[model samples]
Target chain A: MPFSFLLLVLAGLSVIAYRFGVSRARAVAPGRQAVLHSRPMYHGLYVAIWCGIPALLVAVAWVAMQPILVKGLVMGGLPDAYDALPKARLDLIWNDIRNLALGDVVRADPAPEIQAAAETFRRLYTIGNAALTVLCLIAAPLAARYAVRHVSIDLRARNRVEAAITVFLVASSLVAIFTTVGIVLSLLFESLRFFAKVPVLDFLFGLHWSPQTALRADQVGSSGSFGAVPLFSGTLLISLISMLVAVPVGLMSAIYMSEYAHRKFRAVAKPLLEVLAGIPTVVYGFFAALTVAPFIRRAGEAMGLSVASESALAAGLVMGVMIIPFVSSISDDVINAVPQAMRDGAYALGATKSETIRNVVVPAALPGIVGGVLLAVSRAIGETMIVVMAAGLSANLSFNPLDAVTTVTVQIVTLLTGDQEFDSAKTLAAFALGLVLFCVTLGLNVFALHVVRKYREQYE
Target chain B: METAILRDTMHTLSDTHAPEGEAAPMTAKIEARQTNVHYGDKHALKDVSLDIREGEVTSFIGPSGCGKSTFLRCLNRMNDTIDGCRVSGTVMMDGEDIYDPKIDVVQLRARVGMVFQKPNPFPKSIYDNIAYGPRIHGLAANKDELDEIVLTSLEKAGLLAEVKDRMEAPGTGLSGGQQQRLCIARAIAVSPEVILMDEPCSALDPIATAKIEELIDELRENFTIVIVTHSMQQAARVSQRTAFFHLGELIEVGDTEQIFTNPKHKLTQGYITGRFG
Candidate 1:
């Protein structure tokens, strides 16, 4: 049977088990629900869990083991000469046998022994699936019967069902945590492979970052420098510019919304401000490149200043606009959370409205604001599209915002895009850059969380 | 109970003549004339008129939502902070109409300071918390003068010795009673003429409440104090004159000893004797 069809049968079994469990609990108690340790639905859920979990586990194990067993049986039946072939060639032959068993035409005609081995493979698969179906059919009813027989007025079905759910919840969280661990390990492995080819010091400390490695020894001037200073400086410069733009504008707007604006105006304006965050970064990239960059260039020429068309200023400005909602929304919440009693205390002390806000409210909310600004800075550092489209890809080690500069994230994207060989130092460098970016942003996020937590403890 | 009521009425009638008698007459610090307050459509305070005397500790005692706190807040225009709250009346402070638009509310608040039910100290060092009002009002001309003000305020609030060593600590780190005293010191740093306390000791323990009550009695020597309290014993202990409000109306106003011993109104008597809150 198809996997979905098997799932449907199991679902039907669960429904039947639920009804049986509920009726059995009621029959045991007659008309009294209070005599039962838990609600009737809990007993139903208990039966359904017992029926579904074991059958699903069996089906998973069967599906996972079937292929390896069938492949072993098929290989055992292959010609004796196949044992003499190398592992790579043997894998190719195994693929051909699988294709043949699945009724697809092979690239070339296989030997008679291979064709007979395909027959064995198909037969074993059929037997394995049949046994799996029979096992599920048996296990579902047996587990449900056991649960129903054990059902009593004193049974704590709720505890058992809730414990099972808690295990499931823990397992789901473990999956997410393990995925993050897997990504970090993969990045580490590739970066180690990269450092083996290019020295770690050269990658971290060298001044130039041309990643073109010549394919042949005779190729000239393609030794491929990998200095990260220029990228680091570019990231810092752009992040500083973005923060310089975002923090004041965002904080002022937050104050106006929280303290000054009328309630109706705030209700309408807050969501409209948050809409800036919802606009895709790619759209911001388009606006940065198509509109803001040229305008800056023309304006710069008018002032007798030289400005690159794809300057860091354009990208940083647009990125700042994109991050405004993050800083403002969070700052607004923290400001609003600074307890009305604190403001009242200030107002009652003969302080005017502005003094109360400046002296009491802002100081109370400073830690959360610092955390929010740090989070925004991390976002600016990791931001790619706006920098890619508007900030030029030249790794210029300059402090001038009017110059073209490339960031670590932009370089990672450029190095990894399109067809590439993984064995070369060029492709592996992307993983190394990703690891650095991950570490920086992770540090920032952790610090932000710590500050926010400290602020919460202060008030609560 | 009937004889007690009759005796209270007689005492009130006789004492009514004593205030006007004249050799050294008591003066009104704040005079409210037919004050009306509304929150949207609810009549919170209805046609109330009373006088808060200078150099005295006067307490307003009533159950919850009896408009006692509302009337206390109206003294310094703290009600202006509440949205949709309206106040209409003539409130004369030191013989000047405080509700007049030309009278800056900020300066008025400086003259009439307030302490809230809950101690709300700014998240600053204890020294800075006390110095906040003086620094804002420019009451101190220099750092030394500011220090003097802070020291005097803390001394007056009876918190200086306990917190003198930890003046740099955050004001919120103090114990509940110490924090409340810190707020009181913070309010007094600017040297306001009157202090409006709305259940200031409600959040304190008995010992802390006693310390604060003692502090309020000492403070009455220099500042006019109007307090609103739920504990009748607190009003009887700390206040010279007591006003009993019930259902948005002043049922009786008399000397504290008279109000507690011989309340003129039946509702006041019941409330004082713990019949009903």
Candidate 2:
């Protein structure tokens, strides 16, 4: 049966269990619900939990194991020559058998022995599903009956329901944790493979970064170099330029909104400022590449300075504009969080408005502001689409914002986009870049949280 | 002492005997004439007029929201901070109208400092908290003078000996009473001519309140003090003159002894005798 249909059947059964559980408790209490220890709904929920959980667990386990068991049985009954075949060839034969059983068109014509195995596979699958349905029938009613029989004035149904919910909540949280672990492990494994092919030292400290390897030994200009120094420096230069643009503009706007703006103006202006954040980064990328880059090039030439058409300055400035809301919104919250009492104290001291904010309010809110800026920095570093479209792909290890440069995200996208073998050094290099990017962002987030938490402890 | 207590009680029960003369000399430091304050059409203070004598502690005693604190805030233009709050009529300080547009509110605040009910020390070192007012007002010429001002202010507030060793510590880390004293020290550091305290001991424990009371008594020797108090006994203990307010109206002003023992108005008599708020 489809899992959704099975879930619907269990839901119907639990609804019945809930009705029975509530009526049973009422019957025991005779004419007075006041005699029951817990609410009627809690008792119903307690019974529903028992009826649904055990049957659901069994059904899930059966569904998970059914295919593996059926495949094993089919493999065991295969012809004697299959044992002599190589593992890959045997895997192809098994795939044909399973596809034939499912009544899909097979890739190849099946021999008589494989045809027999396909019949056996279909029969086993039918029997396994039927047995699972029967087992659920026995389990749900038995658990529900037991729960209903145990219902009394002293059952503590609320406690049991609470415990079950706690377990469910924990399992939900573990899903997020396991997904993160799985991603890191995959990155680690692929990067290890890449390092085996390209020396780690060259990837870390070497100055050059052309990943095109020579297919022919005599191929000219294809001696691929994997020094990541240029990419790292390019990332740093762009992020620095972005921060330079973002911090002052974002912070000043935040202060004006929080301290000076009237209620009607702030209400309208804040959302408009935040709309900058909601504009897609791809749009910002194109804006940088098509508009800002050309404008900067023309302006720089007019000023007698050499500037690349696809420059880090353009991408960084556009990215900075894209991230203004991130800094402004967080900083607005931090400044607002500085208590009215503190402002009152400063004003009562005869300090001017500017003096009060500078000497008292800003100092108190400093740690949270720094933490917000750090988080914005992490956001800037992880951004890919902006840098990919505007910042050019030549990995120049220069600090000049006017020069063309590429970040790790841009290179990772370049390496992974085209058709290529996954096992090659070029493709695997993407995973190594991913691992480094993930680590840096993770460190920044952790440090930001620490700083924010420390600031909170100061006031409260 | 027993006979005096008996006679005071006898005088309080029958509100006919006029009490002794005013305890302080008659010299008005801040005089409000027919001051009417409105907060968005709610008449918070209605045509109130009173004199705050210099070099003496005067107390405004009233029920909650009786507009005593509102009248007190009007003295230094602190009401200007509130949205939609309007104060009319003339408030004269040293025979000059303070409501004149030429007068800077910042300078007015420097001359008239305030202490809130809750202890609110800035999130800075204890020394810095005291030095903040003087530094902003340019009361100190050099670092040594600044240091001397801070030390003297702390000494005046009676917090010097307890915190002398740790002037560099954040002012917020002190105990509740010490923090209140620190705030007092911060206010005095500016060398203000007048100090306004709004229920300064309301949040404090009995001992802390007693110490603050003692400090208020000493502070009156240098600066004119205006205190709003909920505690009738605190007003009688620390204030030389007392003004009784009820429902945004000043009912009577007299020596503290007379206000408590022989009130002139019915509302004042009712409030003092615990008949009704």
Candidate 3:
């Protein structure tokens, strides 16, 4: 019988439990009157919840793991000639076996050995599925009968239910925690792999960066240099410029709107500022590429200075505009959250309105403002489209905003975007960059939360 | 005392009071005549008239939203701080109309300082919190003079002994009662003639309440104080004059001893005797 049959059987068993529990409850052991306490329905439900929950989970786990376990056992039987093949080639053979088992045809070299492997794969999968279903059929009702017979007034059924729920919730929380740990561990391992192949010191300290590799054994200008210093420099320069624009403008506006602006004006202006966030980064990317870049270049040219066609200045300016809402929205919330009592106290002290805001409101709001700005900086650092479109692809290792430069995200975009050999150092470099980006952002987010939390503790 | 007590017993509420210049004249530091206040369509204050005497503690006792605080705010034109609150009355201080168009509300507020229910200390050092009032008005010539003012204010508030060592510490770092005193110190540093306290003891413990009440008595010697309180006991203990407000009307006003001992108006009696506020 399948697991569905077992569930139906348990449903039938619960009906029997219900009927028998009531009569059994009425017919207590000679002098033990408190032996049966709960209503018959509760006894039935208690047994049913126990039987169904564990059995279903077990059956699902078995169903998911059966195919992989069987496939591994079957693959172990393959000839040593097949076993000695490279892992990638073996993986391709397994893919063929998977496809054939799922009735997907493959046009690769068809040997009798390959055909036989496909057959074994399909046959074992059906056998395991049937075996697991039968196991579930016998397990659910026997478990339900035991729980039903044990159900009594003093049995603590509610306690058992609560414990089960607690376990389930803990398990769900662990899944999220494990996923985060897995991602960080993978990034750490791959970045370690990247560091092994490329010299760590040079990657951190070199001035120039150009990642290139030979297309064939004979064709190469350079083997490839993965000195990541310039990419890091470019990311920092753009993020610095972005923060320079975002922090002051965002914090001051948040202070003004939250503290000074009349209700009618705040009601109108806050949403209008938020509309800046709603416009897409791709749109800002276009604005930077088509309009702002040309304007900056012309402006620079009039001053007898050379500005790159795709200047970091244009990308940084647009990105600054892009991240303003992030800073303002969060800082605004924190400023608004500062108690009205503080402002009233200032006013009562004969402090002028401007003095009250400057000396009182802003300091109280500082940590939250810093948190908002840090989050925006992380956002600016990871920003891809505007930089990719406006900041040039050359890893120009220069500090001047007028010079064109590329960030980590833009290089990652250029590297892993099309058909390519996954084994190549060139393709894997994208993951390495991704790993680095993830670490920086994770650190920044943690620090931002820490600062904001510390600030809250100071007052309340 | 019997004749005066008899007069308090038979009084009924009237916005218009007969002139009390039988032998000489009555002197009022601040008087509101036919005062009415409205917030949008809500008539928050009915026609109410009263006087706040100088160098004495006057307390307004009423239930919430009865406009005792609103009327207190009107004395310094603090009603101008709120939007959509309309006050139609003449409030005179020292025989001058405080609501005259030429009178600056800011300058008026400087001379009529207020303390709020919750302690709202600026996120600054103890010295800065007290110096804020005088510095904005340019009361001090230099930092040394400002330091003296802060120290003097703290001493006056009785916080000097506790917080003098930590004068550079954040004002908000102090305890709740201490912060309230700091706020009081902040208000007093400017040497205002009149003080309005809006439920200043509402957010304090009984012990803190006692300390604030004592401070009020001490401060009354130099400043005319108007306190809005819910505690009848507090008003009786601290105030020289007590006014009972019910639903925005000043139902009765007299010496606190006589008013608590024998109130005339029915609503005033109801409020004082724990019947209904």
Candidate 4:
């Protein structure tokens, strides 16, 4: 039996002990009520967790080390015949033996010594797991008996239980923070490796950005430049255009919903607008590429201006349409949250409805509105699928939206996609771009949080 | 049970309570004739009739949700903001039917200003807070005139000297009392004929309550003031006339002295003597 299974049986016995303790406390202590010290429910839960969590934790520890122990014993038992083989062949034989012990069907051939080692591995697993479980089961009930008997009137069992819950919550939160740190460091490490091979100055400030360096030093026509300026510039231009399309339209819609529209109209329009945000970015990508790009091209042709088929304008406009609900929903909430007292105050001052909204309501909600805008901007910058599908791959660093351009996200996708070797600078450049994007978004989020906090202090 | 029918019955009941406040010795500023108020199917104010005298402090006292605030709000058309609220009969201001379709709510609010139960000052500079009403109505020609209006209004509310040096500070930074006074100043800035207060001292401390009470006494000489209060003693001290309401009906109306000292209806008797308010 595993340590966990033994602990599980101990946990059941602990509950029985807890119940006996409660009945014993009632009988010995001379209380009319059957319950004493803590509530019956709390007592049961307390004993159960004590019997379970700690011993189960040790069971986990024992399980983690089991493979290492089994491997060691098998290696020590290997006959001298196996030791005579080459390291590769010996490793293969050991691998086969380990697999055979686990009852896995492995392809490699095993010697007589390897087979003997496999038998020893199975025997050790049975002895170790069963011994651990049986020992834990006996230990759990004894501990439960001690804890239940010691629970006095002054003992803060509830507080201890609450503290345990708090620890669990903190641990879960630490996982998220740890994962974020891990991702950042991974990006940093890969980006640093790429920077070592390609100059940082060139990657950051060079005008030409084409990463097609050959593995063979003497190979002809495989040399490449690695300027990231074009990608950055393209990202900025596209983001600006998206904001241009999204901000006013979304804000106006929010204002209409909050102020002018009736409840019936608001109920219909708000969800319809939110549906825009819910549509997948892939759908947006296809719409931008197939429908919007050609439209922009023809419209530009009519105006006698040349327009690329995969123009940033097309991609940005579609991206803007995709993000409008973000602006509308958040702004609508902020605007609606502008207290009814504020509106009433303005109205009572001989101010018209529009005047009240413009001077009083909007000013109160300004910080929230700014924070919403920042969130929208960061979303636009980090957006990948739409730009990847619609925006062209060529890094044309220009302010003109009608030109074909590429963002850092699009390049990052193209750089690492397909079966590329991880050690290559091209693949690692993706991590460098990811690091930059993460920093940008993180900064935006922090700034937004600050603004929102300040806003809350002012109004709420 | 519908609000419309309640108002009709209230008009008949109003006669018994009509002469409560010395019959407005000067003249009636705004009079409600057989006017009733309702929110959805709930009869908030029964067909109630009363005269708000020019330059006099009149108060309506009642238990919680007894429509004291509802009646005060009707003077300035503030109830228009509530979706299901309906008013019948007529609320006349200076012989004009304020409830008529031709009347503009914004104009009515300007003519009849209100100070809410909670002090809600605009989150702007002290100067701008007072200047808001004047600016919206275009009461001033230039920055100098606007500055003058702000100072005069602040003076009227007795907040000018305290806030004079810190005119640009955010109005929200002020204490609860000062914020209420600032709201008062903002109301007077528009120079309305009447000032309606809805339990103005409910959110204030004792000292702030006394100051506001003093301001109300002084304001009675210039503006028609109607205050709503759950506090009977405060109503007795400030208001010349007092109206007692019980369960959406005006039980009695009389001079504060008479209302406090004498008995009229069983409900009114039950209320003042602390039998069951």
Interface DockQ of each model: 0.75, 0.65, 0.60, 0.74
**Chain B TM-score of all predictions, in order?**
0.92, 0.91, 0.93, 0.92
Local distance difference test, per candidate? Answer: 0.91, 0.90, 0.83, 0.85
For residues A1-45, write the lDDT of model 1, one tens digit per residue: 877788899999999999999988898899898999988888998
Off by over 4 Å in 2: A103-105, A215-223, B1-25
Query: What TM-scores result for chain A when each predicted structure is judged separately against the true chain A?
Result: 0.94, 0.96, 0.87, 0.89
Question: For candidate 4 chain A, which ten residues in a row score worst on lDDT?
Answer: A26-35
What lDDT score is found at residue A383 in candidate 3? 97
Q: Pick the winner on DockQ between candidates 2 and 3.
A: 2
Q: Compared with the true structure, what per-residue lDDT tens digits does model 3 show for residues A322-394?
A: 8888999999999887887887777766666788788788888889889888899899999999999899899
- In the range B74-148, model 1's lDDT, one tens digit per residue, is 899999999999999889998899889999889988999999999999999999999999999999999999999
Instruction: Name the better of 1 and 4 by TM-score.
Output: 1
Query: Largest lDDT belongs to which candidate?
Result: 1
RMSD vs true structure, all candidates: 3.4, 4.8, 4.3, 3.6
Q: Relative to the unseen true structure, what is the C-alpha lDDT of residue A159 in candidate 1, on a scale of 0 to 100?
A: 99
* DockQ of candidate 3 compared with the true complex: 0.60
Instruction: For model 2, state the Cα shift of residue B120 in Å.
Output: 1.0
Docking class of 4: medium
Ranked by DockQ, top first: 1, 4, 2, 3
Model 1 RMSD to the real structure?
3.4
